[model samples]
Target chain A: MKDKDGVSGVDSSSSGVNRRDFLKVGATAAAVAGASSVGMAESATAASFNPKKFAGTTVKILLVDGERDQEGIKDKISYIQKTHGIKVEVTALALGAQLEKIQSVLHAPTSEYDIIDNLGFTVSGVVGGGLFTKLNDYIANKELTASTYNYPADFPAGQLDYTSRYDVAKNKFGGKDVYLIPGMHSGSVIMFYRKDLLAAAGIPVPKNWDDYIDAARKLNTGGVSGTTMIAANDVSLILVDWYARFASMGGKLMSGTPGAKNYKPNLNGATAVRAVQHMIDCAEVSPKGVGSFGFTESVDAFSRGDVALMLCWSTIAGSAFNPATSKVASKIGAVQIPGDANTSGRPIRGGWGLGIPKNLPQKRKDAAWMVMQYITSAEFDKYQFDKYQTDPNRRGTYVDAALNKKYPYLKVAGQAMENAKMLDVALIPECFELVGEAAREFNLAIIGSQTAKQACANAQASWEKILKRAGHLA
Target chain B: MLYSLGISFFEFDRVAGKWNFLGLGNYKEILSDKVFWSSILVTGVMVGVALIVEVVAGVSLAIFFGQKLKGSKFVRAILITPMILNPVVVGLMWRALLNPQWGLINWFIGLFGIDNPPIWLADPKWTLWTLIFVDIWQWTPFIFVVVFARYQALPMDVFESARVDGASPLKIIRYITLPLVSSAVVFAAIFRGIDSFRTFDLVYGLTFGGPGRSTTTLSFYSFENGFVYYRYGFASALSYIMVIMATIGFSVLLKWIPVRRNH
Candidate 1:
């Protein structure tokens, strides 16, 4: 699988971070796993760093499955034990089951996982509810975070706001209180387009919603459809598709604060209706029966070169650019989500957060922080991104010159993170309910069973009823 | 059951980690919930249609196989293969086959000069029927196996006497064979009905209860509220309601059928 650059997608050979070389000695050295052989040479330099401080202690972690979370960490567990002197055990679960597991453990009188990965969608609910221990004290301590680790500054500010800090008292986002740290991955949606098709048709890249629709219509020729999207009855439609369009159009999702008595969704507004209508129009140029597509179908369509354009998660669909698994790898180009005239396209922030449960013993919390710092270090961030193409949360890794040459999409995705916005409804615990209800209604609209107005209106009513039942509305 | 019964009396707030007593509030909420009622309607249509098709197809196959024709044993073995496959695998296989763009079902139909076949899994009008068809395809063999065993065990002397008495084939089957197979048929119907009523895995793998709740069943509804929404109390009440409904339905069925022998 050769790319346009004539480099094999599987080879990190020319770059100093050859996976085979790293795997050869990964069992003996910890810092080597984090820092590539050609980079800073941290394994020898950080020799004074004592990993055996808590040698006998074992820290249990719960990680979400998929996209290099468990794989990245599991590959380095032996190295971590050697360096940190703490044994690591990881239990990974599917997205839905992970949420249930977190809820069950946090509600129990005892703790099962010393450190847990918080699914980004549930961060506001779990963190706002005070399920995790505050990590500010640990971050401030040199021994826990290490001397060279830049602490919070290493991660993008937007990611920190979305995954780390939560205002427990106000039950809001963007407070100074840090409860979690960005782990294994952080990502947002970006657009992937067929450069060859757009070039052949003499069409420019779409910059706004109106331009996007026009381009799609013109591209819907020959055997290929213009574009594909995830509008199936899945939560991703709410996250990646609707929210990307709505927020970019400057639509405020909710009018009131979470947990406020007057809190209500702004679902039936003009912008909301227009966004749904735009999605319906996009449906016209998509492959037949795309109304039922989830991530699998939409990504498969783009990867198979059956579609000309796609807007999808960077972690999941970013691989379509790799020649190893995609037919259009050399022909595709990626960019930040398209913006409208009024606002920039802000793809809903998506990722996992690492945190220690509040009920854990202090010693365990300290040991857990050690492991967290090691896995999330800037060096490890670059390592995993180069090895497995896991989305990186650190600013330094995305901007690394060597990585950009291999994966050009990283720069745009990193820019996307700087301006990304968290899903507003996700701040509340009933997030899935709001998103789920709206997803179903809008799905009906996409399938031509209802008008955009009718779908938005139905969604508004369902939201109001749910809010009232939860005592968020009077 | 007792634990769910208790939870039904309380509202468990998963986010705040608190539980409050609601007494019969959960029940009252479910009674007026539009989604709950819609789910019941969907479940009724799906179960009713699937049960009728499965029973009829199963019995027809059973009687055909009971003739003991050549290679009947080999054909019977092949017939039950779908029943043995995991429901998840079946759903996935059909999901591929029913794909509107590239699926074999539409492709085969297209070869017959039919263009633009209905999207089997996406269109709201067709999704429910498609699911029912898949259910029948997968579970009909279970009924066939049960009724076929009973068909083979029946006394041969009765059929001999009926034939000697100059009864026509249709008359013999109506007066003697039908009566003998009545108990087995009733048992199979009740068994298949209960299983169909509780369908979840297939729906999860198939449409995920949508094109817009058109394929949602009571079990799927209960699952979404409990696991998806984390509304433990409300979901518990929904489950208990389904339990009561199933019990009442079976009680009526038993009363309607005369399982006792007249002799």
Candidate 2:
């Protein structure tokens, strides 16, 4: 149904369920319905739900636009609007500013964002604060399906696991059932190298920790700096990368046992100590004045051909490959970061998701889920890779012939994805700050300002104190 | 009366609705926080050092330009130009200048036979002082303009009377000029002190309180905790503490120096 003002006329009955009733009914229905509906809805929607036929529906999506996805999707906005008769409004914000805006909006009871992109930092908080709708019901009820959505299969299993939480200790639905759907699978901190430079230096592409050191040394002799990583306040990205490597080294940041909130400083353990020493060794070979490098500085240095290698996100891959933005574009090659002996087989994974705001009307929540499902469908995964150069999170997309042909490096990313490990840190609300503080001390240690033992000890002490304040530490 | 009533109402709304009223809880946390205390020490050092440099340099420039010379007006205009630029812009300009790899400062330092110039903003120990240097460069112009105006407005007769008494130029300046402009000096100190306490834009743009929190000031800490970390209650507590400190500092300065009247 469509109103004169262009708002979709959702059934009034859908709005009657209160918060308590929905919580009681939603979880039970979701679990039972999810298994049966996986293959049920493919034909029902594909035959009838035509975007061109549906008119007068407006969808508001909040997105961070500075990255490749936003730039790639901007051109398609008009096409989607014209075809579907759906008016889509995208609000582009700086990454940090977007987080603050979303948090402030979520904190207010009557806030009005229908759909929001979910950063890893805000996912737990948003869910715990009851600011997001659980999508398990929609997925289970067959209201949303793989055909209707774009990225349903593009997501990696690990990403899906991270997005979904189990309240195993309490044997509950964890307050919400899968609050987010992985929209863009662009999270791995890939290492970008100058292929030409490596060839000139007669060095092989680094595969493991030892290879990485040897390559760095070879690159250093040619007047080219070894590698660059973010060490600034926004060093959370790099810290996550380091955690992935530590996990590869068989060092767990926290025990995965459910119900246990307090975590010990396993970072001081042998595996973690070795990993930190490896990072310190890498730091010594990094360019002069690497201590103050943030995401922008590190990326700029790599793109400008000032550094031999940059350990950063796949999200920046498109920019690094563009001839206009990068001086070393044609010479650049992608590879998974080298893991330690224990983690040599694993790769690090990082990315964000899309979810409905819990405060919206039930009809709006359903509509938002409809939009999310459509955007993450198989078709859209191809569209994203073709247009935006974003890596799909799904295993199938890794082997897509079209994708492989257009972006040969997707194979490298796929290999990294196969070995990808999640950050072994706690997913609690204060985890970001705790990780940031620890990373700062770790960076200090890497730059020779503090010893590895001293850095880990100091980080443990600081983290213990922070966790104590948050009631997570005994 | 109206203004007082409005302020009271605003204060009531803020206390009742905005703040969580954790009372001593946040204060206790701040007291025990090593990061908080370390930031306080850093802020104190920065403000103290920058203030001394700004006042001394600013006053000297003010006195220098107070003398009549050809193109004096043009020189005065150029000297006060930095006061009009935004703090963020000033910071970015200086960050570019101080960049170790490509910076003009490092380039200039290389010409002086110093082969290895220190990474000014990248090193933990030098970041705070480097930020202070940028602040002094930008805000000292404000002080110079204010003090120069004060110098221009000084009575010609008082200096003439001092000169008739056989007082040297230095003596006349020390006794007559300095005493008359004491309020202006106090004004500059108090204003600069209050502004420096809340300084964020420049420091944020330049150092981002980094190289391991070496340049993190109290205001920057408050912003990070409140906005970045989403600890609204703790941030509110920090703001209140800053307010009390600023009020006390201003009150003492006001009491110490009475405003000059046009007798």
Candidate 3:
């Protein structure tokens, strides 16, 4: 696969799937036609979708533990051995340990696992560093990928930019370069509400932040909290809760670039203060001790029928629709997050990506891509969602009429996924530090210990110091 | 240990996959960092309050259990259950019980006609206190078990002599019984103090350092920097400072609390 130059024999046929443009040509007008034209099935034209492309190789996949990333693949192990004729080994680890392992191995001369899953936030660190081989050649190589294996066209553009593509030279996400593929499941932040409660209160559904707060205040009664969110000192506090309001309200997170050394964070701006104030207002109408609520606490409260509204990652709160785990399962309705007047809802993208290491032997890299292709295909996407409830990364899966009829939230989650914005912090390695500091300061505001202005000012100060230490700021 | 000390002088460059020497830069940065100082204060308060309550409660229980009253065996066994449980589990259990809404604690207090009780995990005033209380609940039994063994092994002749010499029961207990178990009490206190000083998992499981850094102990802070932020140098420096503080604090404690093995 090697040419004179390029990362891992990357051909000159544009790093990104050119079909993205062709898919964009007709837009949603041809979505169904789009899915059918390029979408692959498990048993397709044998010449294009050969199950035995790599008949006698072993491929190992490293996946996250609790997200059910392994179950979909594990359940089909026998089929993989029989159909693909490749021995598949899967090792799943908890979040913290898995991230550490990814970092340690990404730089090794030879990678132990042929395929590794990349969390969206860690994109700038590992992928931007060019630790993974560029996959442009694989996507364009017809022999390697099936013709019916729809890629850039079938996946949402936001998820593609966030998880699949990278601009290594500029040290940012989403450019012409394609280093990874959105794998398994992808998700976005969506607003969840109680249909029963809203109907009883005669309150119209919220379309923006202003209407949202008004509805929350009016509905905060009868032993049910108006809203709950990730207000604790967790990274999700910033990524999910604060960013939803801030981005929707037209807040710009930062300016300049890391290389220019003028990267200045604008946490103390008016929009930021307003977003924080909005959360504090919601906390007033929320359950007692809402300041201490993390994802589990917030989701549990909502599922137990004590909370009237919430904004959460669909992948996580999707369980709220199951009767076995939720008292309000039948009472729930989900929609895209509300935006302010001028702008639209722009929740940050959330999901993992699958990539091959740059240092892998050529044979394994080829084998890994063959497995990745089948796994990310629209056929597998449908099966995984149908079987495991893992979120779907493909747009076609979201709009699948049959799946949407069964899981109503699929339609709303798809719309949000298309509109989702990648967290600007994901562009830098100091991301966790930046988000963590902001989460703490805002959490203090949510608890009423600090005013919204003070909290924003504090976050501003801390972020600047971190940016300066990292030499990304003057 | 030596590698951590060495790593303290260097900051890791994640993208480049190498370390850049920043000799004394990390130390200087940590010394001026407000979060580090606040964590130190939190650790100090947690260790002091939790250790004192544990020693006092444990010694009191040991003395009472030593009386060998009816069913004391079963009660003693029940009292040490928290001690045997993992610290993280203890933290999580207390967090659930202390949850302001729908928690068993609030419900129980409500039945007593106290409608408004403290929000244990949320309020800054109570978050740290709740963590300390959980620590005391889990560790006080260690002190009880250790001191009880010594209390039971004490020679009977001494107490009998004191009673024979016209000594009141309370007086004999305070003057004679206490001194004999002083060594065991001192050992348990000092040991508990060090463990409490570097406590990490409880803080991680319970508060995550806070609604606003209210419960951020030094160890947790060090871990947040090292693992969460990937600021290895800063975390290593913070850890070294903790080692120094713990070494000196325990040294002074050992000197102040004299453990007399023989009367």
Candidate 4:
């Protein structure tokens, strides 16, 4: 697929990352990933780093399927075997089954996987419970690390805090201690719209929730619906769509302290009501049966030119910018989720992280680290992003000139990730239950079965019940 | 089985990796849980409605094809197609077909001059019935095949004597045919009843137990708690409650059917 970028999307010859740009990317990565001035400066030079240190060792990886993760790894397996001299085996399963598989693998007498990629939300339960090996010692060892391997700098700081680093003693997300590295992909919510349609309609790019609704109403044409969303009674309803609007509208999600069993939900607040009501308003302009639309349907409709706007994860919706998958491929534009006049859009951070199970033998764990380093490297981040559009983890990959030229959404997505907020409820093991209950109530409201206020009240009640039952609320 | 049953009495805190004994607390919470009771009603409605329709439709088809009419042999082979496909695949296929905007079903209905059609999988009023319809579409064939086999094996003299006695086709079916085939109907109903009681894959693939627990069967709820929520003890207790209900319900049904007199 040749575009104005003058490079083939699949051309292995043209790796978009130059060494000079990559070095610069490493230095400023932390700032781009959203944090105070940070660096991964250790005194090790290139002479100490060896790629083939673990020759002939086999390392197995487990990842959740359908995220375009396994395909890209399979493409590079031969290259890895030749360059790194290690055999890499990857197994990807559907999300629920993979979570169950991780449970069994972790508890097994001998761990089944050398490196396990976990869902970001489940990190609290797994890593917080001390089921993963901390990687601080391994990262500090020059012989085991690549000289240029930018530990937490190259990844988003919010993602690092959520998935990579954990304070086991305090049972909190962020600390200096490292346990995992963001791999496969990391993403945040961004809005996709039809540039041509908005321009033709003279509708300015929506900068706030009110503008968004007005634009959606104006764009609802003879053949096209105005907008779509993940309004289904699925977890994405809460995480992807609703949370973006809620946070951007200045709604605080939880209050009190998690450790004291006094966590309180803010679902019944004014901002929460407005956020849900905004979804209820958008449903009027959405496609028929939009209440049942999951991530697939909403994105598919936007790609097909049947819907004009969508708020979706950058990872799943990247296919919409590809010419092969999308009808409006050339006319699409991506931007951070819109905020009202007073605040900024802060979509919930969504992605996975790779870590070694605590039960694995040290030898296997060491071998797994070598493979893990390569998969999370800036070079491979560009390689996979260029080839498969698996959302790049490194800010350098998102900012690569050739990639930006090929896919215009990269710059906006890069900006979006730097500001993405973590779902506070995800720090608890009952997150799925909490998110699920809210999703059901919001879905009913979106479908006109209940009022937005009633939905919020019900959701608040349900979340409180669940939190109290789980001993996270008094 | 016993491992899950034992786990039912103990809550497994997944993060802490410990099983704390709850004894009857799990069962007590489950009984009081509104979602659990709603799921019970959903499952009850699904099994009751789906079984009756499947039995009636299955027996009618069995009686229709039992005559050995011409081309019935060819049609019979095609009749069981829905039952052959996996329930998940069937659910997905129906979901696509029921898609309100561009689905083939709605489009076909549009040809009749109706601009708007019911959102089959999304609407609370329609989702459960739509599920029951899909179940009947798939499992009615099971009842047909089972009853058809029984119909074929029945002695022809009894049917022939009834015909000679001037009984009409409908009368013969009601008086003689239904009585002899009552055994197969009971067995097929029980078999289909159990499968319908434990409906999970269909709900997972189709509606995912909502617009708000509208189609969440007991089995689907058990799966959501065990797998999605990681509430192992809660899910296990729910499953046991379903078991107790199924045992008592089927036992009463068995006595009510009077299958012994047919022999």
Residues B1-263 of candidate 4: C-alpha lDDT, one tens digit per residue: 89889999999777778899988999999888898889988999999999999999999999999999999999999999999998778978998899887799999989999888889988999999998889899999999999999999999999889889899999998888899899899999999999999999999889999989999999999999988888888899899999999999999999887885634
Decide which is better by DockQ, 1 or 2: 1
**Which pairs of residues have clashing backbones in candidate 4?**
none
The TM-score of predicted model 4 comes to 0.93
lDDT of 2 at A60: 78
Per-residue CA lDDT of candidate 2, range B135-201, in tens? 8988898788788889999879888898899999999878787778777888897899788878888
> Least lDDT summed over 10 consecutive residues: which range in candidate 3 chain B?
B253-262
Tens-digit lDDT track of model 2 for A30-132 = 3323322242223444544433333466677777655655654466667666545566667767676788888766657754566787665445556555567
Native-to-model Cα distance after best TM-score fit, residue B74 in candidate 2, in Å = 4.6
> What tens digits encode model 4's per-residue C-alpha lDDT throughout A1-474?
122432111111222333234346644763343321111112123547677778899999999987889887888899779767899999999888898888889878889999999989888888888899999999998788775676766776677898899998887899989998998899888898999999999987787899899999999997888999899998999999899899888889999877888899999999999999999999999999999999989988998989888999998899899989889999998877887655666678888899999998888999899888888877777778877777888877777677889998886677566667788898888888899999999999999999999999999999999899889998
Each prediction's RMSD to truth: 6.5, 10.3, 6.8, 6.0
The estimated TM-scores of all candidates read: 0.91, 0.83, 0.90, 0.93
Question: Which one wins on lDDT?
Answer: 4
Model 3 - which docking category?
medium
- lDDT by residue (B113-143, candidate 1, tens digit) is 9988998988999999999999999999999
**Candidate 4 - CAPRI tier?**
medium
Off by over 4 Å in 2: A1-46, A50-60, A136-146, A164-176, A237-241, A256-258, A361-390, A393-403, B1-23, B66-81, B151-172, B257-259
Off by over 4 Å in 4: A1-48, B261-263
DockQ of each: 0.64, 0.37, 0.66, 0.74
Q: Which stretches in model 1 have alpha-carbon errors above 4 Å?
A: A1-49, A54-60, A66-68, A81-90, A361-367
Interface root mean square deviation per prediction: 1.3, 5.3, 1.4, 1.1
Query: CA lDDT, every prediction?
Result: 0.82, 0.66, 0.84, 0.85
